[model samples]
Target: MSTTEKSNEKRCERDGREKVDKFRRFLAQFCATTVENLLLFDMGLCHSFPFIIIAALTGFPNKHNLNETLSLTPIEASWLASIGYISEPIGSLLSALITDALGRKVAMMVVNIPLVVAWFLMYSASSVWQIFLAIVLLGLGAGLMESPIITYVGEISEPTFRGVMIAYTHFGYSLGAILVATLNIMMPWRMVGLVCMFTPIFTTIALCFVPETPLWLLSKNKTAQAEKALCWLRGWVPKESVAEELQSLQRYSERYKSCESCIKKDQKCIHPLPTLAEKLKELKRKQTLKPFSIVMALFCISVFSTTFSMSTYIVQILKAYNIPMEPDEAAAVLSYVNNLGNISFLCLIRFTGKRYLYLTILSILFLSAAVICGYGFMVLPIGYSSFPDLSPNFPLENSNLGYIPFVCIILSSFCIFCGINSMAWQMISEVFPYKTRGTATGLTAALSYVLSFIGAKTFYSLETTLSMPGVALFNCIIIAFGLILMYKILPETENRTLEDIEMHFSDNSKKLTDRKIPKLDLSQIGSAKNNSNMPTRPVSIKGIDEQNNKKSGIGCDNRSFVADS
Candidate 1:
């Protein structure tokens, strides 16, 4: 071999090694966000597909020729649309237990089972009852999926990127809305349902490849598993690379575990498990309750802001009340604009401290727009009566104000998509501590859906009695009340870590000093000659600490523990 050939071969080998190392670095960086993003996106799709299917179905109510195929009455159709909202609370409760017990991955996969059944049921259904049942099933699936998705994503992502992850999920929902609206414009509703089924199935399949969250594994006392999970979530970094993160999570879980165990021992000197009341009391501590309270209020505001109401039934409401724009066209436009607006606003969430401003101002704007649009409906209908010579659809000829409702609808949609909808969901994901995250989020979600169900069920009836404009005016009042209440309370969570946020609640500024209870040696007391006539008080951890502290006259010194009876 020649010297020239040998030198050339060595250079080529060095170049190949450099390229491989570069690719490895890229893959490691990409995998961290990529796996989590995909999981969240899939769950987002699962949450939204049912809503998309129903929204598309409501876009047009013509018999079997388009979006609405079922021959059903107004009230019956309203029941069909509202059933999902009604069923979600039940699912939320179930998800809390499932996610806390079985792990987030299992809960995610379990939710898909019912979603598949619901979509499949709707695909072949012929009766109103059958369709209603399917919607109920889908609602259950949504309820079950909500807590785990938000909780799991929040636990898994870094603080710097958490808002973006949440925003992406919101974007996924808007994308689903846009896709279904666009597809229903060209395809049948049944086909949309069939297509929607693919999301949950694919989500389940994709989740199989991802590990459980490190926090969840840690909570289960599986330290080894938690380390491996952390490594995977960090993009296959060396186990040593994630050691700091793993230690932090373990410390958190251990602290929580310590706070949860009973300190009192029986005569046998063995510590028993904490009672149910003790657990509930622990959760009610200032750190947990404060955030939980704030989150619940925001959750209520998010729902009543007409986020779910307008998203699901804007098409039906407009078409039923004789609005000029095509319902499906309006939905598609609204979803497209919503996605764009959501993306734009989400970009600002991390950079700005204007979350409260954005929420309050935009929410009021949204509800007011709804009011004006509703009034347009009322005015347009009355315009027909005013002009005896013209038809109802000819309101544009009489006045240039005909475009007011469509403009208001667009304004309302822009406000909601741009601010409150995404903010509220992201806040819920950020607010709760890990110990009670599932329970608090689940309960708040259930309550949110309760408000949603009320709005959905009463929308048609409210329109019937008060006209569309009147209903909007009514919702405006309710939403304004909520926004005002929220403004006084909601905390800014942008670019903040989970621990940092909890510190605000757990910090020493509150001066909630623990009252020192001197542990009494009961055996020593039993043998004391001076306490022969004293009453023996049972030492239970319930309200015992308070009662004993108030009346037991217990006193202590450094050298020896003493109790005054």
Candidate 2:
């Protein structure tokens, strides 16, 4: 080759290398943020450990000598299995206060305290009461962490990645459950608890390194810090690189703060604090009421789908169904399948819309439940009869039928994790407006846990009264109804920003008129005008048309004004 040609080729190679390096850096930056958010989600591991532990204790009492060691009664075992869910409501309520007052990152770290103590209590627990106490603490920690983490992820993630990020909460949970279940197969329950205690401690240490979400900082009126945090979260980019997003967050914060009534006496205000009745009236607004109703309904559907009940009672349920595999082994297998489903969800959510994916998943879930119910009826001779003492070990002639329940359970679990279960939590982070997100999420989550508590607490009784087949049939019906409701009302949220979502639920007649206009700083406007790099876009101001601007002698322009800053 000629010397000039060789030089040109070398230049081309250098250009290619630079482009590859740029892409790598971009990928690494987002990946770092994703990993940090996911570590926070490890709280789910602590949250789910109790359910699997209870399953192990009840499913293999003789193998683990828990009956001989603790003399636990069946009633006590049922309480032990279900009691955690009841405490979650209280924790969720407290989390709202903490999340709003202290900030999301602090709320997340504070929750780990209860989790660590709970695990320690479980490790040292001797009596049933001690175990009960541990389980309650577990529930408390789970509730306390739930709202803030979801809120944090939503606030920090890019819109393109938000669905996957929110869904990771379920991924974290399934991974945790799988770990605990696998551990149970190999070790004693107490030792497993001891090993699990370190997760929260490690989580706390790791959280100290992650930044508080920029939106929360902006809400607290820390503009510079919000910029810095936003910059770091976006991979240590320059402030100007994220200026557009930072300004958008600023607008949201300012809008919320402007409309809120002053509660502090020091902050002088002419308006009085809203009365109790007036405050209740505020909640009745379309923005708050609609999303709250939708989320609560979703939670109800999720709970009655038997997802939590199955998790808490998987071992017992499998044994009752006379599955071909050992109950513990089967439970572990299902946990693995659940994790796979969560992984599938994380992948599918990127390409599919939320409403369609959810509806499709629920449809499959209904079919799986129906199949389980049919299998139960076929194998059990005394179908739907109250037979609490029915042996799970089937005769040789019916052994082949055992695989049906096992396969059906695996499919049901997969569908639950892939769509209905994860989507409920994802919607919690998505549907609510920024101003009321913390309180709204807490309220919705608390009620959801209440439903879960009822479902879990009543599982044994329901199974006895309705029979195993009856329980499956009931779940099938609930899933079918929930699917229909969702089809009618669930809105598409794919690729939409938080503001767009909030607007979707707002009263159309009042949306434009009622929107609070944020007061702009004159200095920022001047700076933005002088800075050639700043982008300009037209902004619509309510009650200010082009003719109004012209009449006011402001300037000659189009229908919308430009707010470059």
Query: For each candidate, what TM-score against the reference?
Result: 0.76, 0.82
What would the TM-score be for candidate 2 when compared with the true structure?
A: 0.82
Off by over 4 Å in 2: 1-43, 51-59, 62-68, 260-281, 383-393, 509-565
- Which lDDT tens digits does candidate 2 get at residues 1-565? 9999999999899778656544443443355445445444454555556555565454455265354365444566668767888898999988888998899988888888888899899899888789889989988988898778878878876655567667765777787778777887787788888988888887777778778888889878899999887776665667775665565665556444532433111122345433435544556567787778777877888889845675766676677677788888887898899889998998898788787899999988888898888877876655443223444444537677778878888998898889887888888898787657888888788888888888877877887678778888899889888987887777766666675566446533433223232222333333333332221122322123223433422211110011211
Instruction: State the displacement of the C-alpha of residue 272, model 1, in Å, after optimal TM-score superposition.
Output: 6.5
Which ranges in model 1 have alpha carbons more than 4 Å from their true place? 1-59, 62-69, 260-278, 281-283, 320-324, 354-357, 360-378, 381-394, 398-400, 507-565
- Residue range 17-128, candidate 1, lDDT tens digits: 5566444433433453354444444434444444445554433442334545556555565676577888889998788878888998888888888888988887788876
TM-score of 1: 0.76
Best candidate according to TM-score: 2
The CA lDDT of each predicted structure is: 0.61, 0.69
For candidate 2, give the lDDT: 0.69
Deviation in angstroms for 547 in model 1?
A: 40
